[model samples]
Target: MFQRPGKNEYLESQERYVSLVPAEGDLLTILKEQTAEMHSLLGGLTEEQGNYRYAPEKWSIKGVIGHLTDNDRIMSYRMLCFARGEQAPLPGYDENDYAAAGEFDRFTLKEMVEHYGIVRQSTLALMASFKEDAWTGRENSMTRK
Candidate 1:
């Protein structure tokens, strides 16, 4: 099992997120559990509810899922590169821009939820393939300008 990341592993701004998980928690199990929880929660929403944005500028349910899916894909790709010892810098992304361009509003809520589940599974599979060293031996290779 991988040890929880040190404070230096991630940015200071991300401490809140990192702290939410217990140091002893099993990362793979937690991720698997969350996938089922999110699928059930999001899959049960009605079409109208999925399209309802609370504010003029906020993302709707589908948009949020799309953003999450995109985020997972990017994160997993970075993990893949780093685990393999890549040295290139990774690029930053704008979530709002990605959400807007995704046009998730066009797909049914169920589709978006399913897609999210698939992406989550892909991430899990990639992580599972890594040996313990891949999780702890590599210095963080990800960087943004």
Candidate 2:
């Protein structure tokens, strides 16, 4: 009744997410709720907290937030491609490199979070535009291993 991805819809490694997923709601609804919760969490955070990192090599809070937004955009792009039945193999990204390149330390927590919310809204619009078959569509993730 909902748009839960079916068996083999994603890679075997992603089974944990599928397993943990509750059957109580739809995908878009869950996405909306999660995004709103994340947005609220970020909105109240201080700039000092954003500058801290658990370790010298680890990402700061701002970098972490940037990474989350980047990942969401990447995932949404793949979802859009798959929903449209794109047959080309998609390229993978090096997330650590992406995090390093983002230079999120220069930006405020609010800015990174706002970007996430914007991307999420765009993702919601994209999902809303999908046809029924798109919701149930299957595609081979190039990074599956």
Candidate 3:
């Protein structure tokens, strides 16, 4: 079941984004519903459309989707570390670098969406295995300049 995270549960820098999360339902419930909604939203884009960028130097649609996948992986890893009570500081990743290296424009939009779905399923499973203590787990906040 979802318990809204307390003010101290996450770092202040992330408050804006974390605050956007739904506070009324379990994590899995939100994940499941959002995943379905995301799939529906992006499912119709074709490879040609995915390659379209709104402006020069901007990320293509596929690149944007790929970055979302990368974010999911990175955040999930952080959650796993916190859940397992890992005391070591976790380093951050550059989403732009990951997106560039992913070469998402090489694939069809369908492939990118499919990849997200699979990763999300794995995330759901990992989250489902958490114990109550794990659910409430916290980690030391490490900041980078």
Best by lDDT: 1
* Comparing 1 and 2 on lDDT, the stronger one: 1
lDDT of 3 at 29: 89
- Write candidate 3's Cα lDDT for 38-86 as tens digits: 9998887667888899998789998998998988888788878877877
Give the CA lDDT, 0 to 100, for residue 52 in model 2. Answer: 90
Tens digit of per-residue lDDT, candidate 1, span 66-130: 99999999989988887888777777898889998999999999899989998999999998999
Sort by TM-score, top down from the best: 1, 3, 2
Residue-level lDDT of model 2, residues 34-106, one tens digit each, is 9989877878889898889999999999998889889888988987777766777778898899998999999
Highest TM-score scorer = 1
lDDT ranking, best first: 1, 3, 2
Instruction: Give the better candidate number (1 or 3) by TM-score.
Output: 1
Model 3's number of clashes is 0
Q: Identify the runs in model 1 with alpha carbons over 4 angstroms from their true place.
A: 141-145
